[model samples]
Target chain A: MSGAGVRFDGEAPAAGEEPQSTATLAAVAEAAGVSASTVSKVLNGRSDVSPATRARVQDLLREHGYRRRGGGARQSPLLDLVFHELGSAWAMEVIRGVENVAREERLGVVLSESAGRLTPGQTWVEDVLARRPAGVILVLSDLSADQRAQFTGRGIPFVVLDPAGDLAEDVPSIGATNWQGGLAATRHLVGLGHRRIAVVGGPPTMMCSRARIDGYRAALGVAGLPVDPGLIREGDFHHEAGYAAGRELLALSDRPTAVFTGNDLQALGLYEAARELGLRIPEDLSVVGFDDLPVARWIGPPLTTVRQPLTEMAEAAARLVLDLGRGNAPVTRRVELATSLVTRSSTAPPPGS
Target chain B: MSGAGVRFDGEAPAAGEEPQSTATLAAVAEAAGVSASTVSKVLNGRSDVSPATRARVQDLLREHGYRRRGGGARQSPLLDLVFHELGSAWAMEVIRGVENVAREERLGVVLSESAGRLTPGQTWVEDVLARRPAGVILVLSDLSADQRAQFTGRGIPFVVLDPAGDLAEDVPSIGATNWQGGLAATRHLVGLGHRRIAVVGGPPTMMCSRARIDGYRAALGVAGLPVDPGLIREGDFHHEAGYAAGRELLALSDRPTAVFTGNDLQALGLYEAARELGLRIPEDLSVVGFDDLPVARWIGPPLTTVRQPLTEMAEAAARLVLDLGRGNAPVTRRVELATSLVTRSSTAPPPGS
Candidate 1:
């Protein structure tokens, strides 16, 4: 009972209780008078299974206590994708990626938002368990220790996307090369001969934001330039924060020639701030952003920024979770896709260059 | 046998066959060995019910043929919100509204995309029925007669938001006042002394678009201005269409001083077209858009447009459907919220005036 492939009577054993007999797939199929593949299909909630046949197979499985290796019921034909917030183009990009894969796998995707919190409340876990989705993908969020254990105990696979905090090595996660993205953005500005550069970053607590700021500093260090403490500002990753940060940076006695933002929304706000002060982009103040969202190109003086492959990252997370759900272990627990710089009209040689 | 609240034994009666006895709430509670409130909560999939207790109550309900007044099984405490596409800020606004109400009600939301089709495919209904959500809200889409009947037969209430076509009086719907919105936009331009106003509207087949175009014509008639056939263009409601139409209109020898677009995305494209042709906003060409989205203010020279209360409309739709799920019929089958003009930097007196 302590080993894999355990079985029991009609009633599921109580938590912490071990059963005696172990039921094999072949044994269960033989007892149910069905092929092993048919049993598997029923367990996977495939649509091809006839209602009566599925009911019969489910009853037989329950009676034999045929647990699928680990502890949990059959996987429902749905996947849950939770986001920190669902009100941005960035979220839409990730959703489209997940939907592409989910559609191909004939799985429905459920979208949830944590309502601007770091993670969903305790009831979110209960809801996920009740639905029994095939897997869960949480973007910019993490599960608590207890929640993680519950999912592990139930053999529910979950993958984190762009985790907001330090992720344990054992946890499966997908993210972009934030450090390299930051380095690349700063290097591009350096190449344009702008030594006086300012940084407008996201929450000081977020891991990704810290990584990006570190990259910016690393670039400066490599260039043998001094890091100006007054030039760095940290705030939430939103437009209003960007506007405020930009105003402060622009009002400096010796203002920086270029500004780098944590994300594109902030870059837009910076544009507003500059406009209010009667400054022209590229000519008066060069600006760079990250996350190269769709609107990055649509905005006036198409933004030059770091391109994070949001869609690809989401797709990878979806694929990894689905593979795990299919009883296949991941080759690696952590996957980080590359990021690059997208040069547009927003950046040019600094004033008086 | 055919009366309301009828129940049967373990076997569900064949379609068209009616049962003789109706299992009362007391009988279901007694058989399941739970209080009436507990049974009711279990039937509604309330989070308060323990898993074991819920399973027991569900089994008993099936054995006793106990169901709500309508034909379907108990609600799943989940609501499905299907969108034509989830790749826009507009969708996000609606989702936020629905989530606000759903959070308060302690109901989970399931978001789905119809993938740009007019309606979800045939299998969508089956998949939805399998989940057994309390109700469904469709944005800019409609169900066929057969699909509507299927939901009706299953006791699942559905409401349409911003319906793309003519909805039957019996179908509940939520929409903005498109005619009034269009009227206000055109009147703003007319009041600015722009007699040669050009209209870039959406597809002729969409009812809302038609209403908007009609409103434009009505405004011109009220001002004793002749409708300029040459200035009217109709296409899909998107950026590319607006850009193409703007180019065509601007290419004309007798170009209008101002242009009014069906939506904000199209308005943005018009801005690009005007910029590429060396025209300045308000100074050279006044532009008025509809659906004052978030970007309307963010764009250079904030767009003067019609305010379509999308979030409020979505909230209203969600509230209506939840009421229907709770056995309350809507006070009105169709609800149209008000739309108003938002004057910003985009519109001004025609250049010469």
Candidate 2:
């Protein structure tokens, strides 16, 4: 037991598998007949190398399945962007927009959801802090006032996505103009010459749902129309609730000629309910939605709805996080991205107009 | 400016908020009119402090929003669990299962997503790793083999929820046995006196699709029934694809007496397509599905399906990550859980039985 070293490298801690015994960089350099640093440059594809030499090195590495490590730390002067999970196609559109800017900046991204819904005794903040991540993009899913304060107080440099705060003003955030989204949907219906326009919205407590209702009323006011109480329906953000609300609205003595739903999923339900009642979209009743989720274009008659600038929000969130990570002070300003009105087959002038 | 010494025993940074500046354990202790260590013990929920003392400390901290800085060399014990975006409900279910164990262990969690789909040149791993989380949970949608190997090589403790790995033997993974889920679904129909059962499945590249096909074959073998290649159909994991596949399968001269689909979403498509063809479920034909997603029980003529045990898988994944984090040299085992058949009105004895 003289002082000979016992190596604790890639050998087993009694693990039964032998598959992990791959060639290391040191071993490869020895066999390839080149210095370690020289081998590194060739493997990373960083600088000039003769074509024959590069091929020879790569072939040798391939023979032993040698993987070069530690290259991911190159530190591309780019932002690390992230997003909370939203939807399939809806998320993709936002990514497409963000990629254009990120490519220009040579930035990397890690799009991810914040921890699940804010509940008592559960928050991902502590763990997120441990990661020493450059900056954070937190998509707040209805956290309580206290939770918001705690998150903001930590001062990790973050931008809140799709959220509204009852917390004190120091927190940073970015979001689409949801109130305006509601207004646009209602105005589109009014432009179609419809008077009895009903609204199917999401949870009453959600900020987006409330803002949408405000916008809907504003558009109705602009058209010189009074809001009808019976035409309004509160819904959860899902297809089933949208269907139920549609059935209720369609059955009223004063049925609406048009209906505006809070999101595409709810709008899909509205479509189902209309079908059951033997109503054709736009022909018998006009339907418009908010957030214009991806499937809105592919399903049934393309839906006429307001589009949230998801990609812009993502890019903005990334930029804001970068600013925070750079030791700059928190940006107290809240960013508001514009939404567009997409006209499709789901809307038209009311029948007999 | 000669010899103007600066001593930073408890020196503050440029927090620049209140006149007192930085918000930290000491600052909160000063504001609360208590000792700093006392404040720390109270905030961390130590039991030695009197209840009255703890309450007083908590009340003062809450009154003036104070947060202690993390990342102070102790390192974060919190784990980051990432998933792809879809509906909040699905992610919530998995979280429920994972949190049940994580919280009990006093380990905090960080959440993230890979956005919708993988985009070219987006280093999602960078964004996630930047947090320097203790470990990671990749709730992968679909991953290429190279991607899986990259993490394995880094020695980062990770577990895949649903992997697309030919290297399953070498990776630490936990998922429902899809083929067994499929066989359970198919056998349910045969138990109800069904014959000529047809299948509607998602992209063949998906691991679950392959597992389901294996199950379908195994069930038929046990029943002593001849395998009919003509009865099989391919589909994407979407409602529309299921609808189209259902219609096409029904059009065959020797139409199936029952149907089996890869997922609840696809089964929903089959439901609509069957309605369009004027077919009554469990009357003209019986239908069964896999994945037993939330919507499976809510729709009309509620669906019968094979449940994938998502909850169990999430819990197991969390446990595995924790074990690895503890520096235990554990073997990478593919832990497979069981699936069950959920009976509902959508299935019955095939017609003319």
Candidate 3:
């Protein structure tokens, strides 16, 4: 859906017939022993409905496979973009991507942060329901099963953008090729005659991080180099974590000649660590990072990083959600855009080589 | 209204009596020769209303000083935050600040970018009117006179967060002490025995930039030093501008040993220029920057900069707009937060000293 910097790798599945709902609102209301207005209030997320009545109505709506009538008139000209955390240049790129789509669609973006939670709070869902946005694009965040059911019955479509961890296969999502990016980064170092390469990974809970680390190990295996368990370090994808890991790695009697970082921020931290220890980049200890953020080029010696195409991914997510909102079932539920390596000043051959 | 960094310099002008509206919807409809429903449609921003009738109604509304009865029930649980452009970590800070207030108040934030237009387009105004957010925050952007009047008639309160250029005296705004920041930065360099210091300024159209340059001139005058026009350069608060200015300044036969930049991004650009020319920070040049962005600390030599309290300013703007929306008059319409100089490794005494 993005205009640039994205390659689709998966073939679309054949389109299937749209599912027709076999139940009406009156029937559901009768079965739940509530007025039709009560069902409407629940659908609109009004807080006046009692919790027990709301729960009973929701179950009946799900059981009946009730879907609200879809049309532009019923939907507000807005798209909700929720983030796990809004802290870095990373989020800015995603926001820009969504804005690109929003501007074209003449829709406003309602932004929310989950405040470190993978799923947004109940209040956020209620607000989204009340606003009746056309669709929602979630960045590294998800909706609970009940939340998903609520939106499903109300005919609100949502697509997850670059989910940090693994998600249900049925969820519509967009992500980058982390495994390929990791393979490319490690291969470049190996081709440059780096045998003792240390790999610093992001949080273990994140599927993308695990995929990248797996790719790193796969590259080592194909290159006829033994993967050194001692050389592997884990970080939470922050500068301080990188610094701590860098110090631990460099303190060893036989430190690696190059370090592959989880992300650009970690690479920056490693830079600070190397500076404190009187080591030069490329000339002494080469480094490669993921997520070629803006600061990657501005930093001293410039970082060679994997381009994640974050903005493009976000744009794709927005487009997909809107399409779903328009009752267009996508051929593919999950799409991962291609990631490429951008080599700059951060990587070089081992000093002795 | 931020809990920190800001200082109240102006005493409150005594609160004036609230203006009372003598006209009713029926009277406006009678004057326009339209039904009461048509007047209601105009007030609700319904597109069905003819442009001629809508304009007439708006005129009557403003003429009547029609303040919609103030109440939470009439407003959506949302705050609109509009930006000139959503780029860079600078915007992320502002978004975070606004998010802080929005979360505390249990309101969603609707974000829009003017797409580099100093004033948002009419479409944005229409969308905002339709959304009926409790309040709006404009960052480095302004509303047109007509746009302001429309919001005034609708009783939608808005505040400018750090107006880039001069705004009307009546416009409520929050900004940092750019002049004092510039004075402090230049004074730091002057106190370090650097006489031939240069300053790189942001866009001349921006009032904050002008104030900082004025402060630079004042600092030079106070220290009994001559201001060199040849050493001064203008940039649009970007890295490339800083790099270009740095190159020109460094190539001069009698180059200055110290430079102060308008912002941190420019400072980073200057660092790149110095690096390319085989100049070392503090050893060959001393530099200072404005806006203590997160990257300042992560750079090679941590940058010395003026902390603009951007997040705090944004929070203040949000609070002020919400207060105005709740029919609470602000003591003062303008607020300036304190900017303090953070001395880091980027600045030192002149090379020869």
Top lDDT model: 3
Candidate 3: TM-score? 0.89
> Across residues B1-353, which tens digit of lDDT does each residue of candidate 1 receive?
01112111211222321343234556778887889778655543345677678667666766776544534334555778888777777788898888877776655677788888878876576666656667899998899865675466456789999988888778899998999988999999999899889999998868889889889999999999999899999988788888898999988998989998999988888988987899889888999998888888887878999999998998899888877766675679798999999999989888877
lDDT of 2 by residue, A76-112 (tens): 2323233334333455555555554544443433344
Candidate 3, residue B316: how far the Cα is off, in Å: 0.6
TM-score of every candidate relative to the true structure: 0.82, 0.61, 0.89
- Each prediction's DockQ against the real complex: 0.15, 0.02, 0.26
Cα lDDT for residue A226, candidate 3: 99
Q: Order candidates by DockQ, high to low.
A: 3, 1, 2
Judging by TM-score, tell me the better candidate of 1 and 3.
Answer: 3
Show the colliding residue pairs in model 3: none
Highest TM-score: give the candidate number: 3
Give a tens-digit lDDT track for model 3, residues B134-236.
8999998998776787787677889998888779878899999999999999999999999999999999988899889888999999999999999899989
Off by over 4 Å in 1: A1-73, B1-73
Each candidate's clash count = 0, 12, 0
The CA lDDT at B313 in model 2 is 86
lDDT of 1 by residue, A43-138 (tens): 544446676776677667667755545333344567789988878878888988888887776566877888788867766776676566778999
